[model samples]
Target: MTNTQLIFKKRPIGVPDANTWSIEKNPIPEPKEGEVLIQQHYVSLDPAMRGWMNEGKSYIEPIKIDDVMRAGSIGKVIKANNHPKYKVGDCLTGWGGVQQYVATTAENWYKVDDTLAPMPMYLGTLGMPGMTAYFGILEVGKIKSGDTVLISGAAGAVGSVVGQIAKLKGCTVVGIAGGKDKCDYMINELGFDDAIDYKSENVMLALRTKCPKGIDVFFDNVGGDILDAALVHLRMHARVVICGAISQYNATTRVKGPSNYLSLLVNRATMQGMVVLDYAKDYGNAAAEMGKWLAEGKLKSKEDVYEGIENFQSTYNRLFTGEKNGKLVLKVL
Candidate 1:
């Protein structure tokens, strides 16, 4: 049978828009030794995908021209051969690319319980973004009870979860998002103490007014000026967790570095970077806790699911538009 695939055409200068990809209908390759064939149900669309399309030194290799565009996906195993512990009909998550079928080794694949959450949730809160928020906040940010936590991009997947998790930890949570609806969801729905509509008002002023004692932990997703604003309002020994820089992802020029980094010295604050893959061994335990919170209704996971891989370019670009409310996923099946 033939499988539809989105191939990386050329390295993107900024965003991976219409010119970056080409579609192909190719024969599905049979699984080799220690491999399983996946009938992918959902493909994860993350801001990190834009970074992967560029050629540079990073945590992982760049997507080469003519190769299948790399993406995370959850799917059912339609066939398996030469692999122990994996069977047909097992739902799993892996870097399956933007394709209808994937034949890959079990090394990167993890079995997911579709019963606990929907299939797409596995690619969202129950998946990488959830793990990212878990480790980035609790571990790297060093959050404690009664501390004030400020999050940028608070309505997006990782940021939304970060705010909810901070609230659950007894921290006074504040969020900065784009519009009225996003800010409303962060405050009224997600239980954040304050919400800033960056599109309407000045973020630094809003943060200063909301967090008069200063920010104890800043969980930054959208960087650039927002990161600078956080730096300006840091409390003594504040932790600045650099989880992502979505604001600078599509920059044509060099990424704008924070100008207020000197505040870190004044506050004796610590700024650290976190890569989720570093905590791979601890995912199961973290997922268990997050799952319990989800079950108990203390934590919420939201997904913005799209349909069809053929519209992959526009769907991927939608992330930068600030229109999506949660984790963005594309239904491939």
Candidate 2:
């Protein structure tokens, strides 16, 4: 059988488009010693993928020319060789890229059970999104009960989880999203105390009205002006978790820095950035907790799935455009 792989056609100069990728078919490979052959099902489409495509200094190296486009995926084991840890028919999560099949060592992959959760959850909340929210809050943000927490990009995958988790911790959570629907989702569905539509509302004014106690924790996902707005409202000893800068990801010009950083000094607050990879050793702990929350229905994950490997590039485009409402995944199966 032939495996279809989406290869990087060229490095993107700015926002990526269809020209950045090319698809080709090749014979599927047999698993080598201690390796497994997987037939991929779902592929994660993340905003961070844009950073990984650019050549620059980062936590990880950029994807090389002509290489298979990098991604996280959930797949089923079709064949296994010399590895007792994984067997045929076992579902696993790993770097499956934008491909129909994958042949790699089983060590990097984690076994997943669809019976416990859907395949998309393995690519979403139970996967990187959950880990990102878990570690970015408790480990980086250091949230405390009764603290007023504000989150940017509140309706997206990571932001939604962050706001809900903050609420679960007994904090007054406010979310900043793009529209009334998302704001409604935050307030009515996710249990956020308040939400501000950045496109239609004054961010600082909304924060002032909602967070009468001031902001004790800021979980930032879109880190441009929204971050600046949150900075001005920080309470004493506030903790700011810099999870991502989605607003500036597609800029053709130089990325802008936060100008209101002086709030840290005035409020005696702390701002820290964290990469989810930094906590890879403890992913199991976080995943288990998130899974428990999910199983109990205390947490929910929203996924926006687009089908086909050929649609990968276009589907990724939706993330930057703010058209995607949740964890973006490409259905390769």
* Candidate with maximal TM-score: 1
lDDT tens per residue, model 1, 1-333 = 689999999888886667789989999889998889999999999988888888889999998999999999999988899678799989999899999999888687899889879998888888999999999999998899999999998899899999999999999999999999998998888899999999998988888799899999999988999999889999999999998899999999999999999999999999999899999999999999999999999998889989988988888888999878789999988
Q: Give the TM-score of candidate 2.
A: 0.97
Clashes of 2: 0
Instruction: Quantify all predictions' global Cα lDDT against the true fold.
Output: 0.91, 0.89
Candidate 2 positional error at 37, Å: 0.3
lDDT of 1 at 61: 97
Which clashing pairs does model 2 show?
none
What C-alpha lDDT does candidate 1 achieve relative to the native structure?
0.91
> Which candidate leads in lDDT?
1
Record all residue pairs in model 1 with backbone atoms less than 3 Å apart, i.e. clashing.
Answer: none
Instruction: For candidate 2, write residues 304-329 as lDDT tens digits.
Output: 89999888877888888788878899
Error in Å for residue 102 of model 2 = 0.5
Question: TM-score per candidate, in order?
Answer: 0.98, 0.97
